[model samples]
Each structure stands twice: as structure tokens, then as C-alpha cells.
Target: MSRPRKAEDPIRLPVPCNRCGQHHQTVARWPDGGVCGYCYQQAKRTRGICAFGHEGVLPGIIDEQPTCRRCSGIRLNVDCVSCGAEDELDSGGRCWTCALGNVVDDLLTDPATGAIAKDLIPLGATLKSMKRANSGMTWIRQKHVTAFLRNLAVAPKITHEIFDQLPDSRTREYVRGLLTEHGVLPQRDELRMRYNNWAA
Candidate 1:
């Protein structure tokens, strides 16, 4: 006769319900998350409504994420091309502030520095057309003082050293303040510090 049957023998297979909690018996382990034929059928019924509230296929249904909407969505935090700061709001690939008119300014004018400021218009026009996402050279070219060195004291990078040296007696403060207000520079303090450093 065979040996007495052992009543307390451990089972080799895991309990089915224990595998998937609610649908354990119907769920078979797959290379991905899990494979529940029953769950798959349910998901198919719920397809097309993106879980993200957008009008598109639900992400991760077929084990993949869906493409986001072109407009009205956050991309990621990034630095502002004009300000060199990461305080911009992502609206797709570009920041909302950049998309808006935060970097445009009327031409600078002052009776005292009128002639030299007029000479600076060419570089100003070039910067006006430059795209926010492109290189900063267009902005940099404005620093050269070929026509008149007396009016401009700033460098290409618009460093603190250069900004501060701007003759306070001239319209530089007003012009720089205008640029700062328009988002051409990061802030008034940054421009002011540069101006102060240069003055020192």
C-alpha cells in the first residue's frame, strides 16, 4: 500500500486569487504588468477616453502612454531665453511668458543721448526679430559701440560690470529699466547691479 497520505503537505502552486487579489484567477503574469483576459475586455469597452481628460486614446491601455494635446498642457519647467531664469510657465514647448508679449519694448529715446541711441537702432531691430528660443547673439550684437562709444557702457553679455558704468547722467537708466520691464532682461535689480558694478 502507498504511504499514508500527508494532510499537511505544502501546495506547489500559489493560490490563484492571491495572485491578482480581485481577479487573480483570471490574471496570468505577462512580461508587462499583468494579463487578465477579463480585464482586457473591460478596458476595450473603456477605450478612447484618455485618463488624462484629453480627447485621445487612454494612455497605457495597450501598455503605452498617449500623446498630449498641442495646446493647454504643461511641457516642463525650462529657462527663459531672454532672462536666463527657469521661472517660465510651460505651455507646450515654449513658456507662456515667452509666447506672450513679455519681451517687446518701444524704442529708447532721450534728448541727451538721442544721437547715439539712434545709432543703436540697427542692432535693436535685429534683436526685435530674433526668436526667443534661438541663440542670444542677436541680443549680444547690440553692445558694440562702433558709431559712438560715449553712449554705451554695457558689454555683449550685459554683465553687471558693464551696466553699472552706464553714465547715470544719460538715459541709460531709463532705457535699461524699459528693457527690464519688457522682459528683455531678467529684472531691474539685475540690470541695476550691472550698472552699479560698472559705475564702481
Candidate 2:
């Protein structure tokens, strides 16, 4: 016996173009609206009118108004170089706060201490001027004193030995005072207690 034939699906009819009012075989509706292929191509090549009445390719949209590239340039945000903070860039490409803070930090951390040395030491003190002062009591600048103190604080060398090696008696006294005040050097009583504990 022959089997019954299945019903075929109906063909889709072409829709009329909204812009050209002509029926197109491949006309498709867009989310914003519908337009014929020819009309869409013409619109793509045409420059849009901005709110300022300037005719150009729109690069940005602000407050529902299209803006040309030149008009959009004013909205760009410049960031600081050092901190990445967003603001109008200064001549140095840094924000005011970051620029000031960086300048202060550089002044305090500069390796060349000769220029800043006088500010760190007592007035009228005679020391041999050298990049780094060692035995024989050569004059050293404030940067050298700062570097020595920082090294002593972080280095594993014995504190007394390092202190004795300082070129100037006055500088050594100053470093010792600072280390003592900061508790970097243990007190004699504290050392004696630690020894007693170890012995026990």
C-alpha cells in the first residue's frame, strides 16, 4: 500500500521597502528602523549635522546631540603620569599634588648629598667635603649622613663596629643619638636580660 504524502510548508513572501516603497526579495527590518539597501549606503557616505551645525562624521554623542571630532576633543580626560589620577594635565603631565609630593620625596632621597648636606648638619661644623666620608675625618654632606643612618638601620652589620667606623666624631655622636632614640640599638639592661634568659 502507498503511504500518505506530508503537507509542504508555505513559501515566505517578500516585504515592501519602507523608504523606497518597492518590494525587495531580501529586505530585512532593523532594530532602529527599516531602510532599503540603496538608502542605507547613501546614508553611510553622507556626513551627519552636529548640534553646532557643523557637517562632519560624528565621533561622539552628548546630550542627544551628535558631535564632530573637533568638538569632542574638549571632553578628553588626561591622567597624571606618576599616580594615574585623572585630571587636566599640567605642563609636567602630573597633577598638582603628585608633582609637589614627588619633588619633596626626590629632595629627601637624592643620592648626591652635597647640595642638601648643610641643612642636615649643625651650622659652621667643619668636615672635609667628600662624596662619602670614611676614616681620617673627611667632610661629608647631609646626603652621606642620611645614607649612613639608613644603611645602619637596615644592614646586618654590628652596630658598635659600624658606629666606630664613622669619619667624624660629631656625626658619629649624632647617628648614635638617633639610633638610640629609635631603639635600633638594644639597651644594656635589655641585652643583659636576654643573656640571662639564654643561660637559664
RMSD score of candidate 1 (Å): 20.0
* lDDT at 176, model 1: 60
Per-residue lDDT of 1-200 in model 1, one digit per residue for the tens? 12332232124423332213333333433323453444433332232445456553221332254322222232323445654534323344444335332322222233354332433444454444556423332233244321123334223444334656655533355556545655555564555655776899
Off by over 4 Å in 1: 1-154, 190-200
Candidates in order have lDDT scores of: 0.39, 0.44
Q: Give the clashing pairs for model 1.
A: 160-194, 163-194, 163-195, 164-194, 164-195, 164-196, 164-199, 165-198, 165-199
TM-score of 2: 0.23
Model 2 root mean square deviation, Cα atoms: 25.1
- How would you encode candidate 2's per-residue C-alpha lDDT over 36-92 as one tens digit per residue? 555433332334788888664543446645465466542333457877854334447
Model 2 alpha-carbon drift over 4 Å, by segment: 1-147, 150-155, 187-200
